[model samples]
Target chain A: MGTWLALVASLNGLAAGAFLLGAFGLLATRQMLGCVRFFRLQSLALVASIFLIAIGMRVPDLIAVALLDLAIKPLLIPWLLRRYVREELFRRREIDQLLNIPTSLVIGLTLTLTAYFLAGVLPPAAGAMGNINVPIGLAGLLLGAYTLAVRREAVPQLIGIFAIENGSLFAGIAIAPRLPLVAEMAFPFDMLIIALVIGILTRITHERVGTTRVGALATLREGAPK
Target chain B: MTLFVILALPLIAAIVSALPLGRKLAPSATLLAAVASVCLVGRAALTVAAGHRVVAVPDWVELDGLGALILLLVAVVGTTAALFSWGYIAREENSRHLRQYYANYNLFVFSMLAVPMLVEPALVWTAVELTTIFAIYLVAFDNTPEAVEAAWKYSILTIMGGAMALLGFIVLFHAMRFGNEPFTWAGLVKLAPKVSPEVLESAFLLILIGFGAKVGLVPLHTWLPDAHSQAPSPICALLSGVKTTVVLYVILRFVPILNASGRINVDRWAIIVGLISVGIAAFLILQVTDYKRLFAFSTVEHMGIILVAAGLGGAAAHYGAVYQILNHSLTKSFCFFAAGTTLLAVDTRQIADLRGLIRTSPIAGVALLFGGIAIAGAPPLAVFLSEFSIFRSGIAGQHYIAIGLLAIFIIVAFFGILHHLNSMVFGEPMPQATPMTPVHLPLSSVLTLILAGAPIVILGLYMPSFLHRILQTAAQGLAG
Candidate 1:
């Protein structure tokens, strides 16, 4: 039993490390499609972490939550995006960021460290697996917010928002593995709706503005000279 | 069962409105559903007011005094907005997809109704997100580039906030789990004392900033004026009037729970955050160019006031808070309805271009002026009474600094709003404008202005004993 527990904890640690890496990839990647790829990677890492944490914690409910994340985040959301978003969105690279890649990476590192220190403000995690999941999950969340701050295109920002959710749930799996199945069941469906709405919105924005670079779509502001 | 029916009515109406049966059927069905929901919700509120917790599914679906107040507000605004939309959208868009607009409208109403009805925090979060999803198309209904742009901003920002709030709810669940409580608001309050300060504080802060964005609190409120201005006016009425309040209702659910922890000064945080929103919104209202945007900023101000009142944390302040919530929702909807009629009459949103509307359209000019006075908290209006009660509560509680800042900001916003409305309603005619011919206002909208405006006028003069009881009960539930 001890060896099995050690195995699951170590695997959870490895998946969490990969999850942080995926978040960094999302921050630094120049291509919109690269953002999607990194997001999928992060989601897969999340599934692995949740599944391993379920095993480590002996919570069967989390296994179902992990499966739901697996199906929706990776498989279904991307498919819906592809179906709804224009083909050109994939081909076009979003080079215009509010900050340069190197600066963003440095800030991302700082944010990760900040997350580590911030997680100390909470009590010690419930288990060995939780110790790995909580701070790393927070880093993922902070990094996701950073990605949103820098990314200019519609799709990358949307994906950035997704990463933020992934970050929270990644921590949530370890922290509140026993959350009711009813609420857990709602998460994937909510994500599906978000993808659908954003997908159609991306299409509308592109058709109207002739570009998905939403940051450039800033006609509405206060005190514009009439 | 009635709670379940309140939840299901809007869903049924959405389907009926979506059918290709003529445009008349869509609005009729939507209005019918909205009115029915309000009736059911009114019944529920009376039950709550009479000291009964209406639990549809134990720990899953329930309505308390606080929930009932917000639900009733949403239903009322949803109904008026539906009625206002009948004439507003029919003439403005005249597009082939009018049925689609009503369908989306009904769905949006359904999503809002779900938020206060559901007892589970997670389900409530889902309902809040659904409100954004269902309303995105409505925000971009005109499909104009600017409108679509506003919709995109509205969806991304608020939904991003929703994502952040998801983590907060999880943290709350984590805190609650340590104490073996059910995962509901009532359960959290009961479990709060056993929870650690750091865990509960983090959860509270995360949800505060997360949902605060949707509530149009400052720094997160950049999208509010834009989205509120660009949506069709009836939708603006609903968005500004009830939706922000609906989201804030979720935040208020945390107050007693946090206070129950007996550690974190959640009231102080509420005051600081509320004051900042009110301060910033007051200044923004001063510089606002569009008429609709003016109301949007005032929304931020009103939200701040309620937060401050809630933060003060006494029975009187809590009463003031709920009263302000009720007054703001009603008066603001009327303000938006007036804005809608003015938009139809003049065919422009520019405050500078709207000169001497009294000469061109007396009904719209009078309505706009009335709306401005009522919303600005002038004499003999519902808003004035609520605002006065809050001031009295603050003074009585000895929250001198917050009261001072709140008083200053409210005055600034009042003058700012009335100044703009005054110039627009009673100024020199802009002859250079496009012929300045008076456009005939839509009949349904005219009816809506009269229907919605009556409450603003009547409530100010007479304090109905039942509503007073309801507000008192909601305040107690809030203060715990």
Candidate 2:
């Protein structure tokens, strides 16, 4: 490979690794603020990867996607979360994770490795411009799903969901950067609505119940212990 | 032109209904748009039934026999739900919240309508996701503690599912060579043979699990009961009847492509999941105390039956599946409408709290009783006929184990539903119940109930041959 191509590949690899690290950071962090920071970093890595791919593949639409990615994820979503954190309305400050940090990290690693194996099974997109990012993208997605499942607090769960969106976009940019303009633009707008609705719910929930922990949501179920 | 009107009318209604001057007029305005939707969708259905596909913009917007069938569903259910909402929400008399309610309600209808109209796969996914967002606020419309909680759980879980769906679509997009050719449903089916087996396998599994959660298949169905039970009754009908069908439509779109790939036993997986959902939800039905929740679990059960039919994967089974989709959509909506009416009169959704419903409100009690019978798959109802066809197809395909399991679950569900309805409709009035005095319903609510109810019986006894022929074409389209 030429020097420029090699450099681009290395840059993508670094950003992808950063994405994984951000996921791990989410599992390790106890504070709500820490979870949001990790999500922001993860989204930043995704935006960086999208930017690199846009320039490398010369896809102008992807460049637009990257710009929206920056605005929605790294900037707007964190701003929303930070506003929640500042209010300190939710009683639960710690993540109160369902799984321990170390076990969660190990599971994250296992998921990443499994994603790599899964990607290897598929025939390589022949002559694809980008190289070897699909595995990392899948890894990020699995880990995000794990976070969403394991976290007890609403904010951390929101972060987990954000991470999943980031992973999806990262994977999309790496592997299939040629979606129609409408489909490409829809994800970020969808993100904006998700963030907005979640923000409102979190506030409403905290105000009513004094905590945004979903464990307390059991009252709606068919049979609850008296 | 018809397609554009079908897609645009709900959206225009949504915006106009939200404006200050239109808040009082929201119900009428939305009702008009919904009526227009029915006419346009029926026209499109007729055109497709005549053996020519409706292709308005090639890959961007098109309708075939399958789309036409689903479009017909959105139109009928959307109109009925709006009609019911007029009576349901008006009595609440919270004018301040009515604007937001109608706005989101119309938007939800629009999203469901767009699902069948759009031909682009990614755009289809986007429309499905939009339904969740639009309806989340509606689910939490009452802003009660339980309402918010249900909305929160529903949104988070479904968005996670949406993420996986997005990944699945991205992989499919990549597999299709990044839209080098048309990536529409027809395009993908044509190209499916060339796509690698492993890629197809992975993509199909991901898509199934993702959309399965949205369909309220078991194990991922924790939110379904809660969301449906808590949402306003009219919206509950829409969610149970129309929204789940719309998402399932996305999954069915992939059947032709998966078959073409020739790598995966996609139907077997569908059948397995379908059976599990049917089996689990059947028992869960017996445990639910809320009348709305009882209806909600039934929704899950019927979805399982549809999946099982689709999984049987024969010409007969495919027809049964599509027919079941129509039957379940109409039947479930009518059931929800019944549950809503009862809840309105008795001022409670708890089954134990309701008694002598027929004594208190004959319209609601009769609606609940017959709607329950229809949904429980009794003879001479649409559900029973469709389900019988599914069994015939299963036996024809020699899917003995699946058929046996299905029969057991359907019987269990039958008792579960009737047992609850029997008590609620026939018992002596609960003395402690606040609304011991009989309550009268608005003429509009009664009319909408009849509008939804008559179809359950009429379609069961005799289907128009034209509609039957269209359903056959739709099933064939799915079977490829």
Candidate 3:
């Protein structure tokens, strides 16, 4: 029993660490490909966390959810994104982020602190699960918001969004174990649809402007085009 | 019987419209389905007026006084739009695109109908999200790059807002788990007293911002003008008028819970956000150049006004909000329909390019003029009645500053609308070197104009006893 508990704890710790690392790397990394790769790693860590939780809780439905996450997040989404990147032949080494890396990193650290502070504020409802997982989820939320605020490239912004979803899923598993399985299943389907739509939009963007950068397409404005 | 008809009729019509045979029958079929849905909604409204809650699918779908009021607005406008589409699409000339247009239109109506019927919070979230996805196709139907980009931005912003709402739902589910019963309105109400105040407060805030984005409150309202300006005129009517109201209904669903929990103060926050949105959108309305975009910003302004009334939380204020919703749905959709006719005649959405509408098409010109007056809250229009009630309630509630600012913004916006109406409806017709192909107005368009215009005229002069009772019940529901 001790061994199993230790294993589960260790895996969760590793997953949480990987999530934080990926979030920081997403902010720190200048290259678009590097951010994508970091997101893939973050998704892998998410899969591992869910798998560990399912084994610890002896919940079979969660295992199915874990499998779905593995199949879609780590495999299908990355593959689709790879095709988009290659076809577009993006050569830009660094995206002109809204905020510099240093500033984003500082903001990320503050967000992590806020998450930790918030976790302390949550009253114990789902045992130690809430205590441990809520902060991680908060971190994920902040990271997603930060990515959305800073990133110029459409693809990286999408990754940031998925990362936020990953965090919310983690929080859901910890806080609401009895959440209807149907709702859990709906999450991946929604994500898949969002990914497909984003992919199509990216393709269209590439076709229209010869680049996937969103900032260039500001010609259609209110009153008149700038 | 009524609930099932309301849900299934439009869905079946949408499916049939996608078929080859249904192409020739598309307009009439949609009109028939819409009329059927409206009749059912009217029956539901009557039932609610008689002091009975209509539980459609029991735990999964139900209609209360509030839902019934929104349903009536949706049904009335939907029927009108359907009638208008019949004549409007025939003028398209391009057969394939016309078919696609009707198909999307039917699906859009189906989604809007589903929103009020959905009872479960999670189901409501999904329904609202479906409305966004369905409307995206409509917004981008023109296939113009600008239209497509607007659709994409709209989809992304709304979906992201939906994600936040999903998180809010998760929190709500967690809070509700303290109760013994399943997830339903009754269950939530029963559990409200026992649930943690902190959880309820946080969940309410999340839902507010999440769905508030969809309601096109300022800051998050960036997509409203873009999507409204880009989508076809009929769709603009639905998007700005019915669809936003449906999402606002979802947000309003949480009010009773928040009030019951006694931990969160909903009215104060709603007032702050409402005033800010109304004030910002009113100014932005003044600066806008595109006529469609002007109406689009006006939507944001009106939504802000309704929210402000709702936030005031008195019997009169709540009733005013409900009345404003119905009036805005009628007036805004009428304006859009007129805008569509004018666009078809003049071939431009730019306020400067659209002049001499009266000389070109007097029917459209009169429609635009009257529609503009109605939206601007002219006397003898339902909007004027509702806005007056709201102002009276605001002052009664000791919100003197809010009332003063609201009046100022409304006056400014009225002038802005007048500037465009003057240019578009009264100027001499711009001469075309080549004789232009005359586009005929649809019977549906005429029906839409009448249906949209009727409520404004009738409700302004006198409020029916049944509708007055229904609004009172709905107001009480919000107040609780």
Candidate 4:
């Protein structure tokens, strides 16, 4: 392979690897602040990858996407989380975690390996996207789902979901340069609505039962008293 | 002209309804737009029934056979819902909450009308998601703690599911991008055969699971009962009738593509999920105590039956599925209307709390009885004919297990509904008089009953050529 092409490929690989690594760390961390930091790092890595792609393909859209990632992921979302943390005064660790940090880390590792292997098995229709970027994307999906299943706090779970969205976004960019701007715009709208709804639910939870822990919602079980 | 009118009328009405002047005129304004749109949709349906597509606004929006069928649904039900909301909200006008209720009601109808007409898939997603956001306010319209809670749960759960749907769309976009087509419905349909199987499989699964949540399929239907029970009666009718079915239409749009891809046996997966959903919801129907919830579970049950029909994967079953869609939308909306009226007179939704409805309000009692008989698949009703066709097709396919289970569940659920209707509508009156202001029953309620009820009666006895053509085209599109 040409030297320039090799360098571009290496940068893409490094960016995807960084995203996968940060996803694992986010899933492994017990502290909410720690999770936030890991997610910020993952976003930073995403920015770097987008920058590389823009330079390589000379596409302005990739650069625009990079700016969006830089603005929303590292800066805005974390600020929102910090403010929510202070206002809710929720310091107690989240309860009802389905798995511990170690087991989750192991699962995350297995997912990353599976992602890599699965990418190899896929028929290569998407050029570089089908071969390299898909594995990292799948890893991000698995990790995000894991976080969704295991995390007890609403904020962290939301962050995990954002990570999964980012992963899919990156995969789309890598595979198809002409992805519909409308669909991309819809993602943020969806995120904004989800965050708004979750914020409202958290406030309701605090007012009603004095905590945002979802475990308390078990009172509405089937055949239970009204 | 039709496209712009269909798209803009509701939105203009919604904005007008938010104004102080519009509040007084909201009902009439909304009813006007709805009636106009229904007439336009009926014309579009006829055009398509003649084997010519309604390509409105050129590339931006078009009505093919599938779109026409759905537009007909949105227009008919939307008009009825608007008419019902006039009286329904007037009854609440004495309360401080009436203004916001009318505004949200307008927006909700606007969103539903937009869903089936938009030709772009991404635009359709936006419209569908907008419906959910508008509904959040409506679900919590009463602003009680339970109402607020239900609204929150419904919004959060559905939005989360929408996130998955967005991912699916992105995947499909990528798949189509490589094949020299844009993200329009026509583009996707043209390029679907050449799209990679891996991408097709992932996209189909994601779309199914995501849209399935909105359709109230099993494992994602936790919000239906709460949302249905809490929302205003007319809104409940819309929710169960047009809203969920439109989402199902979105999912059905991809079935042909997935089938043609020759990758990922989607039929088996659809059938399996459909059967399980049908079986479980049927049992749960018997266990529900709230009348609205009983109706809500019935919505889930009917959705399962539709999916099962769609999964059977032939022209006959496909037609049956389409027929079921029409029957379910009309019958379910009528059921909600009746249930809402019953609640107004009885002042409670608890099935055990209602009795002697026939003594208290004969109009409402008979509506409830007819709705019950129609929804329970009694003979000479639309649901009976459609469901019988589905079962016959299933049996023909040697799907004995599915047919047997479906029969058992349908019979069991019917008896459960029958028991509830019998006790609530016929028994001795509850001791307390809940004295409610009797607002004049709007022409819409009577109209909705006739519009929905007449089809059930007419189609059961005689099928019209135009209706049969639309169903045939829709079925052909589904089977691909």
Q: Write the per-residue lDDT of candidate 4 for residues A87-119, one digit (tens) a residue.
A: 434344554577888888888888888877765
Report the lDDT tens digits of candidate 1 across residue range B192-304.
89898888888889999999999999999999998999999999999999999999999999899999999999999999999999999999899989999999999999999
lDDT at B102 for candidate 1?
A: 85
Pitting candidate 2 against candidate 3, the one with the higher lDDT is 2
The lDDT, on a scale of 0 to 1, for candidate 4 is 0.76
TM-score of each: 0.98, 0.97, 0.92, 0.90
Model 3 CAPRI rating: acceptable
Number of the top lDDT candidate? 1
Better of 2 and 4 by DockQ: 2
What order do candidates take by DockQ, descending? 1, 2, 3, 4
Which TM-score values does chain B get in all models?
Answer: 0.98, 0.98, 0.95, 0.95
Give, for candidate 4 chain B, the lowest lDDT window spanning 10 residues: B433-442
lDDT of 4 by residue, B263-306 (tens): 66777877888888888888898888888888999999999998
Which regions of candidate 2 are displaced past 4 Å? A82-86, A89-92, A122-129, B178-180, B434-436
lDDT winner between 1 and 2, please give it.
1
Residue pairs clashing, model 3 = B83-B444, B84-B444, B84-B445
Candidate 2 scores a C-alpha RMSD against the true structure in Å of 1.9
Question: Each predicted complex: what DockQ?
Answer: 0.79, 0.69, 0.40, 0.31
The predicted structure with the larger TM-score, 1 or 2, is 1
DockQ of predicted candidate 3: 0.40
